[model samples]
Target: MNLNQKKSAFIALGQFLSQFSLDNSARKEGVLHNDLFFDKFIDLIELSQSHNGWFTPEQVHYAINSWAEALTEENLNEWLSAYDLSNVQPKTVGLILAGNIPLVGFHDFLSVLITGHKVLVKTSSNDQKLLPFLADYLIAVASEMADNIEFVEGKLENFDAVIATGSNNTARYFEYYFKDVPSIIRKNRNSVAVLDGKESKEDLVALGEDIFRYFGLGCRNVSKLFVPKGYDFKQFFEAIYEYGDIIHYEKYANNYDYNKAVFLMSLFPLLDNEFLTLKEDSSYASPISSVFYEYYDDLETVKSKLLEDSEKIQCIVSNNLINRSISFGKSQKPKLCDYADNVDTISFLSKI
Candidate 1:
């Protein structure tokens, strides 16, 4: 199939996703194929948690809403306008997805297919159900796409290129194993926020969304904080108190209890608000139920340090304190052009 055909299929998928939301999921009367597939999609979303506890209804709805907003014809056209895809040749691109969050690897899947290439996906065990179900939906919308998508069970074979997402350890293995093929091997990276003392209570509350959304699973979730030296924790704590209900979730409560216990046993100093804990550390990656923080004496020094360690950071959330930094609450709501790891997937696929 051609580019417009591919775009039309995804636009249809977007409309289908737009019908569902956390508060209300009424099927719209005019969405294509709603009579047949809409109810089944709802069934899959409801069954998602039984397959994986982390795939709660709230998280699933959030993912669906994000994609629904993204898959519009205007957004798709604006994103693709930057790339020259007319001369692209067809190839089979292998995808090894990470399952930290719902539909985490859908961007790469969309990229491969939209660029006139076939996709051979190997879904992560943690996220086995969601993507394949969506792939089936896409095939149903565009029967021609059945030839463009495949899910592999055993070894991945007969693919010309690859895109693999994993931890630093697995990334090394991917580099060595796919050494002969053109590839984009992603490693573990975490997002951080730089907080000035001047942020409003509203800003801090939004920051809570960045931290607590998806239970802090996705790489885009802010795992660390950079605050001014002697920054008071009073307002920060109060603003985020609205999200205190997050602790009631059984899995999150378990993590809170366990991590808090481990920290106390280790004699570590922790700032606790019952639901979330703040620990002073220099690392970018933090465990669930906690966020690591560091104090900055000067903004310029922090900027220099972040520039030096750019590769270790996925996104920097700030009030424009640093260049290209995202706003307080906007880290997780990435645009279509907000390429992961700052690598241009469309450009990469176009050349291949």
Candidate 2:
């Protein structure tokens, strides 16, 4: 699409989403602003949660706006310039969607769509409805755009290229089957936060949103913390605890307690029930009930360690501003120019 065409498409999609992304008070309700599509989205999320992702009706608007601009802004598609699509035709690709978090399939779907290829999506059982419904919405808005996309309910046996996401256990399967195709095999990754305990009271509140939103089910959620040694937990805990009432999910509470008991019976003392455990070692992802935190000697030392563990970190949220922060709340809410893994996806696809 040309720049003007892309701009118009995004404006339409954005306007559509902005309509429902508002709360009754007319304030910007990031996720709860669904307008007339509330029931459709809520039903899909209910089913999505049972299998894997814990999606709420609230985060959809942000997600849609992010997806639309990312795909058509022309940045994502620049990757395709490397390949000669005139002779390549529109290749069919398989996308094994990730149910780890909300709208996890978007990147893969996007890579295929903006690249001028056809996507045969294998929906995760837990997140079966959202993507398809999204596809429906896209079709309604721009029917021509939907022609290249297909939401497959089953496996991908006849695709030319592959983009599969899974844990270490399934990485081997991806390796064996997709070895013949040019593909990206993604595994579980943990997001983290780094704190020097120098954050202002206001910054901490915004940082709190990074930790608690979506109840920390996202990979971008800070599963660990890097704190200065001998740091005081009083302010950190209290500032965060003030938002305890914000966490009202019964399942999350149950998980917190069960994990707490396991740690307590073994003589582990927790700061509070509201926060989870923070352990050492490298765990790419954390359970919804707990977090694994680490202590640091200095910024330089921690910086070296994070570089060594780059695969484990996604977006870092910190007040230091020296580098990216260690923790964040939202997952994959990229600006128009925010590329995945800092790699231009469309450029990769266009060249294929």
Candidate 3:
């Protein structure tokens, strides 16, 4: 199918997704395939939790809403405007998805299809249900897409290029395995927030969203903090107090209790706020329910360090303290143009 046809199909999928939310799921009349697929989609969303304990309704709905906002005609047109897709020849692109969060690999899926290439997707077992369901919806909306999309269960084969997401160890395996093909092998990267000790209560509260959203499982979640020397976290803790309800989730509570006990037994210093723990750590990857923090004497030094270790960082959140650093609370809510790892997926797909 052509570019306009592909864009229309995804826009319809977005309209269908906009109907469902944690707060409300009022099925609108005009959304394509609503009569046949709407209720089934809702059932799948409800059943998602059984498939993956972390895929709670609230988290699934948030992911859905984010995509709904992203796949608008305006957003789609603007995102695709930067690329020349008309001269594309169809190629099979293999996608090995990461299921750390809901619909984590949807962007790659969209890129392959929108750029006139076929996609062979191997869904992460943790997220096996959602994307295939949406793919089915897209096919129903535009039957031409059925030939372009395939979900592989066992081995990924018969593809010209590959895009895979995994931990650093698995990324090494991907590099070795896909050595002969054009690829984007994504490794584990964490986001961090730089605190200047001057942020407003609202900014800190928003920063709490960055830290706790998706239970801090997604890469975009701020797992580390860079604070000024002798920075007091009293206000930061107080501002995030509203999210204390997160501890009510059994899985999160188990993690919090376990991680806390492990730290205490190891005699590590910690700042606990009942639900979340803050530990002085130089590491970027923090455990669930805990955030690693390090003190910085100067912004330039921190910037230099981050620049030197850019590959390990996915995003930097600040009040423009460093160039291209996103604002507080907005890390997880990435725009269509905000490519992960600063690798332009669209441009890469256009070339390959």
Candidate 4:
């Protein structure tokens, strides 16, 4: 359908998503096709963990809430206003999605469709259900969406361009396979925070949210910290103590125990909370239950190092210490315009 029609369908999906949250899933009147979709959506949320252990009901609901907040009419209008899609030609755009977090590749799916193109999605096995369920809701809201969205079980084919997200290894395969077509191939990138020893307890607590949310699977999650030398761990550890309950999750606890054992056996010194471990390292991508940290001599040197290694970083969280750094805990709550890897999806879609 046209732009407004497509936007309206997504708005309806967002409204549907708003009915569910970590605390409760309440059905609201006036939401489109709720009779057919609401209870089933709740069922899916309850069943999500069976499909993927990482898809805990709480985390799934958080993801749903995040998207609901993002897909408002005003937000959609503001985001799409920047692009000219009036003269667009429809093409089939293939997507190879990542299953790291619930509905992780949805922005790319929305991007392809909103730009007046057909979407051929190859869902990651870990996240095969959520987006297609939303797609069905969209089709029910606007019948034309049936023609615009398709999920492929086998290999992707007959698409003009592709958007693929994967590890650095799979990205190489995507680059070689989709080399002929204009493509956006995403690779592993991690976010980091800069600490100057002046952050308040509130800020550190919020920073804990950035660290522990979704159990640190998302690229936007702060996986590393750049702290000034001699920064005390007493305040930081106390501030993040609220997140200690995260250790109760079996998978997370297992990772914590295993990783900690490996670290100890290797003679690496560590700062251990009951739930999370902090190790001093220069690496950006930390293991699931740990966050790496480095000492920075000065802010300018850290900024220069980050700039020099920009391609490897997804986000920088700080209290205005670094240019373009996000606030303490806002990394995972990126705006619609916060393109991954700093690549503009809308502009890419408009051109293709």
Each prediction's TM-score versus the true structure: 0.99, 0.81, 0.99, 0.99
- Which digits, one per residue and each the tens of the lDDT, describe model 2 over residues 6-75? 3344345444444444243122454322454556654554454455535554444445445544554354
RMSD of 3: 0.7
lDDT of each: 0.94, 0.63, 0.95, 0.94
Q: Which residues of candidate 4, in runs, are more than 4 Å off?
A: none
Tens-place lDDT digits, model 3, residues 155-208: 999999999999999999999999999999999999999989999999999999
Select the stronger candidate by lDDT from 1 and 3: 3
**Regions more than 4 Å wrong, model 1:** none
Best by lDDT: 3
Task: Report, for all candidates in order, the number of backbone clashes.
Answer: 0, 29, 0, 0
